[model samples]
Target: MAVVFVITLAMLTAATVISGSPVTLTLERAFPTNHGVELNQLRARDLLRHRRILQSSNGVVDFDVHGTFDPFQVGLYFTKVQLGTPPVEFYVQIDTGSDVLWVSCSSCTGCPQTSGLQIELNFFDSGRSSTSSLISCSDRRCNSGIQSSDATCSSQNNQCSYTFQYGDGSGTSGYYVSDTMHLDTIFEGSVATNSSAPVVFGCSNQQSGDLTKSDRAVDGIFGFGQQEMSVISQLSSQGIAPRVFSHCLRGDSTGGGVLVLGEIVEPNIVYTPLVPSQPHYNLNLQSISVNGQALQIDASVFATSNNNRGTIVDSGTTLAYLAEEAYDPFVNAITATIPQSVRTVVSRGNQCFLITSRLG
Candidate 1:
């Protein structure tokens, strides 16, 4: 349900050591999935063996992997959410592609009421604050004029509804709503700051098939990418800079990804040159080269013509999917690298290599 940005790190480093502050946001509540029920019961060793470990090489954070959902070219992670006031936890996916953070609603149809994963934060129940509102169909932010396919948004009781289809055909659908979000900010070693920001999110009331019943243990996602409305946008509005996030995919919970608020941790890490592509808004991509060879693909493969900078460089996807032409060359190169003994031919005429052992 949540969209998370993931980065691989070889080791764990302190965020405060690299930056001035180390903010820790802890979730003490239980999730609605079976993993939530059994998380504490299992010993550390058992948990380590069963869970997909993620860490941040340069942050003071760690978390367990609830489950993995692969849709489209995106891979999503479901994790536990704990807020102090609610005393309950919910499962959420961490996404970096879009902005807005939301969870499943208690009143949502088919949503788990007793799963113990709902966010019970006081901000949600405060009589003083207006209930988080949903975006209307007439609103400009809502994608309109399209039939309710998995890619398009729909109108529900005047609110915009969303359906996200992953590359693997797995997706989630729900109504969008706004809510108050809080992040524990760390400043200069011992200084701590807390800020509340408004976030737009999807509260899926009903889900079916693998989506409704996932091993990931969460019902929603958190988008923190370069999109206009992502959590980073809110942070920028609050005057936080150098906002960067790093997640260690192969480490312990104590070693998690760092969501940098205002600056890059190291200048060298930022050395990767950013190339601009025209006609596409936020989509930024140079040619994709395999090993040392460059592949020819359509420029449209980066992003829609209207949103160029919107090009997403995602690590979650297991395979590098590009426009058909680009995919062809990459596949061809791989097949050429292997001998006939290790290659298998498929009915679609695609050849796959069977690896008997590690290449290294």
Candidate 2:
């Protein structure tokens, strides 16, 4: 659903505090690395892909997951996930904006078999896995508030199934199943522990919109949300991982970064509090400044209310959506900070411009 990105999730636990434990994952950018394609051309496609991802706020991470940034193709980053007994590997998009991890299942209706990305896509065959079990409505995990909101019980078999509708006519529906997920846990500073945990995830039967298309399709999505059903929470509940996870993009062109299951403490690191009673990782934006000079915009402009939405840290989206009212001042401050002679246009391929829109 379009509001899936805006839906409220569970409260955070103190377990997120920096400690010795974390789960690490390797990631790959969902960009097509075609040497024949023009860089700008790929950049243009990046905007289109980004728009499709958002136009559909929209809808849509992580053990110590790290990813590469594709300069030519800027899109969602994906990671290889191992599920089932024999452990079928699947490439799933990493999303912090939405809850629930799902993959295209065998006998799927509209799941994409192949993807435009360099990697091959794999379907989750629950029927083949000896350890796989359907999650019934009466199951304790199925009765969670978040699961109950989207999941329904089938009278015939008491199966717990769900249908998530998105505003852009894009959505996914499937049944709940419990399976083994293999992970690499990070201990001490860098020690790695190979591990496995039982997690409840979705076995997608159908998909619509951009999801059904192969251009950017993958096995499914891996959600790092703070819900009982999310892999992150389930692992935390099992004492296999911490509830709090942190993500960061590398400063290099590769756009690579870290997605750790536990907090990472650094010297002189700035700390910010999560807004209480708000969905997602909501943050109180006290101010905005360019080169030490504050933008002449009202602090209230960033405030979240019952009607007006505020700021939340969402990793699912590649671009930051700024409010129209706050755009000019923010841009003006940046423009003033930069020398007039500085090149604003980079061969039309790397042109930089602010994106303005309303988010509610």
Candidate 3:
């Protein structure tokens, strides 16, 4: 459920050493300030996006995430990505909950021309980029994607293509292409240098649902997941950057934060063990405690398995969702802890309840 918590958003997902310099990109809040209706829609869509990823994901990749406690306002984050030899800038959603990086392409059906975020959206033209090459189905990455149910191809063209249908009915489909991903790497933890690497990403040819609308549109989604096709994994596989990345998000009036592809070594940092051998960043949740009181729910309900989905920390999701068993009890405890005097009113298209008082 949606709760007001945290100001600085930080997270680390997996770690490694980079012989070469790791890159840093400009990260900022993607939504406009004071747009209640649009913000609600954005959160609703992100929740559905994570649901689809958690349900369909077959493998797991490791990463670390750390965030300072603050009132996390209504906004999803994005990063600036430069692609092709000429380096066209695109604003892509920063999502750790899913894998693969994709962007709208030329001749895309239903892709929005304008964005409500007021960013100039540019489409990736594979034909225009001399370094761009269409990924074949026979490629190992395509096979890996196929095994994970992330890709497919027909005998006629042999092009590796993929599709995702979100829980909110939004969907995107495109083919894979190999091209240059430009970056500004930090050298020796001190110097900044320009560099580039070959990366495989999506070229969206179609879009549906909210994705086709301009209100919350973006160039594409940059996923930080545990898939072989993920850009972060690709970088880690090489000596360019580690699998881990860090960000400090601000939902304030002046919205900007850090999004860097490097290790975040903070003093006295505590690490939480991720649930072993499961796809998605599943956590071994033992129980839920509200204030000084614990909920009367069994811990087994939070368990993850081949068929049963468990609790996960999704960077893309604006709210936390519990399984059916733990949901009621947890909600009960939260309701009990909070004063009933605080009214919960439906706002922004009935997407969430606006609470007037702080629950401490």
Candidate 4:
């Protein structure tokens, strides 16, 4: 289901201490003021597509998501990323749903040149960067980071090509490249220092579906999913940044938010351990509740096993979804508390109560 929830997580590593100072990135709304409801439709469509993939496949890798946030929608958040030796800036959607930082490259077929968010869209050219280098399929980094163990590599010079398909039949195909990525880390109260680090990212040579459109397109996506190919994993592996990161998203769409790398020195913050070895941030869900009323269901429904895909907390999705067996009982119990006179109306494909007046 397309859920619009924002959750922050802290990923800790026992092997090494965090090297760099904390960095802060500003998140800009993908859509400007007066964006319409069509944003929800687009999100729902994408979420529906993603659900099918989840049901069909388990632990999908080598996937690079296209422009994550809708350029014409108000809910999606994005930022500008400066990369390469000459320091070219590219607008990328900051997503917590997936891993791998990728952008459209020069001469990419069907890639949009402009965005509706009033930003100058530019394609990444490895030739322009003096420090840019191709990552071959034979490289250990490619094998460990983006490729599966069963994947084969021919030679050291063989370019590591990747094809990322989205749920909506949209995808981007490209090769891997590494270059310098710049970021500003916050040192102390409003004082920040600039730093640069070498990282691997995708250079898309072709794109299809929604990525080819300008209305919801940007440079590419900066995924924060739990994967080895993610920027967090690469930086942590190189001792440039910590394995931990946190974000505080504003509820208001127009107001921007903060994405911080490393520990957040804030008061009254509580953290829990993350489940190891899962595609997303897999968490053990205890129970479900509505208005302080916990649902009366079998504990096995919330159980996690080797085959059962448990609960995940993602900031990129637009709606919350429940399993079929869990959904029926939850909905019935919720409607049980409501008056029979209250009619039901369908809104955006979801059931809504049509009460004549507010009755809380």
Candidate 5:
């Protein structure tokens, strides 16, 4: 499935555009301003290293998530999202790691004022939208969607408040609110079908840690996780879109790529079975090989025991990680194949060699 950051989805209606067919959304690289290839590599490397520091933790938000950034890798790829009536556009990160979409709300504290990505940062004001409504504590979505132990409905109107703490000690706290979102669905690389879908999202009033850091900040994040609170699930449940989506990432020179929802017709595309009864899209890893040579390691090192432990294919993760037991063997095999003449260098925890001559 192509993980999608859905802005809006509508039941295919004759008034707007075709229904039951696939629709595409355009995506632009979040790091258009950072031109250095080495800097980008270092940023990606840092993110990979951060993986070692991560551990399973529970926090708020429909999906308890922590967001991290290196100024160079802050915006890997994001899309334009229009929220509220008299719509204001915000460039939001399309994250598949978590569920529940959120944007910094008006009167936000510690949110960035300026972003190096060349887009003006803006806050979402529910008061400004005539179509906006609050999700209260008594609401079914409130009771079931956000499973945080600290969730409380103590407001005068019983408004549901949320606290989202990330693994890296960054977090946001806010209340639940619903508003209209505008989306443009592209067809055949030219024509766009405009549609609006109503969605409930978090309007964060506070942000801390990396979220407060201005160097890599954006308007917010749009999560495409495997939960009822996710944008895809909301659209699918409302009959506005199918349960499947797909996206293609293009090179820097190509400007950007395409993200599509519903049915994608491509004969060149192949399919894989999703590991059953799992939250994220997971698949079993049977073996590891580099350059057609399978590494010498026990296959059981990649095995899963508990239902939740396994390898997952996530769109938000830019780096691949392996168990330390598996990592050593894999690294040794790769280094042995490199020519002795090329000197190796480590930058931001990434090992590399600047070789002008080809060696197999």
Candidate 6:
């Protein structure tokens, strides 16, 4: 169960606000290479001209999402796609670090019986709707093997499946399948009566993980990674060039960020100064310094490699878990700052100290 607590939304909002920017993030198609793939950097000012803000409650925190609707959008829960077929109305986390868009299948085991945010089975079963199908092994979307692990594959029919492991000791395993998706258009405070966009997506059929069991209501997840099969890529192939997404987290649980697509409202947003690095197209963090001290950590700790070059910056993950070397200095700095009276003994018989603070 990869379902995140609504309370976690607060942390997400905080992270988004901290990583502020109005720069245009670029995406490009690439060919596999031993070193790393390359991406096309399109100017942000040229692609985005407008942005819209939406508010939705995830049974806990109410956050904002900034995105557009000229093209369709996909939402996810527990690594499953929440809205796929017609009458698709559900909240989704617009993630840039992921590539798969999936929703819990109709026959999912241990799924909650409640119906509101879950996928509409009637719409999926309707003759008007396209049937969900599995991805073939030959498809480029299928993983050749698990990224950054000893996992290797020899099967030609390795169905579309994902094994998502999270920092919170939670994860999910499921096969990916495709289905038709729909989205309604709203313009200038009114729903466009004649506007509806159709989309294709990969819905997860099976799900099992810690978060899934905890947040039984979560149905699936939507991946927005820099890959050809992602929902963004799908839209781009259809001539929805230069799609953009921006999130502005709320100040509190009641207020969240917006997930915008196609364009952004530059005038209303604040832009962060950009630091150019090797154009992995992934957000690069040269280092993390708290207060004023630079913590010694592995540079790779700040990034995850995709196509040897792209690094995914995930706001959903909590705790700045730096590479092992960096963690030591960070821990030492914190320990040195705290008074001994508030420190707790490390449980592993290590010299590490855990301190509790009482802020007044």
- Which prediction has the highest lDDT against the true structure? 3
Local error of candidate 6 at 149, Å?
14
Worst 10 residues of 1 by lDDT: 119-128
Residue-level lDDT tens digits of model 4 in 79-100: 6788898899888877776787
Clashes of 3: 16
TM-scores of all predicted structures: 0.56, 0.71, 0.75, 0.71, 0.73, 0.55
Ranking by lDDT: 3, 2, 4, 5, 1, 6
Residue lDDT tens for model 2, 1-75: 222122222332333324767545444434434434455665655544532311101011234333445525646
What's the CA RMSD for each of the models?
A: 12.4, 15.9, 13.9, 14.8, 14.3, 16.7
> What is candidate 1's lDDT per residue for 136-164, written digit by digit as tens?
77754455213312123444367677666
Model 6, TM vs. native: 0.55
lDDT, candidate 3, equals 0.73
lDDT of 2: 0.70
Q: Per model, state how many residue pairs clash.
A: 52, 6, 16, 8, 3, 33
Off by over 4 Å in 6: 1-94, 110-178, 184-194, 266-281, 296-311, 339-360
Per residue, candidate 3 scores C-alpha lDDT tens digits across 1-360 of 556432432433444447775655545554444543454666665544432322101212212222222325325677778899778988887777778899999979999999877688999999899999999989998998888777888788889999987656888999999999887664432223357889999999999997898876788888878888888789888767777666556555556555667554455657778887766888888888888677888877888878857878776665568787988787767666666566665566442445655656
For model 6 the local lDDT of residue 279 reads: 21
What overall lDDT, based on C-alpha atoms, would model 5 receive against the true structure? 0.67
The TM-score of candidate 5 is 0.73
The residue-level lDDT of candidate 3 at 259 comes to 64
For all candidates in order, the CA lDDT equals 0.47, 0.70, 0.73, 0.69, 0.67, 0.44
lDDT measured at residue 84 in model 5 versus the true structure, 0 to 100: 93
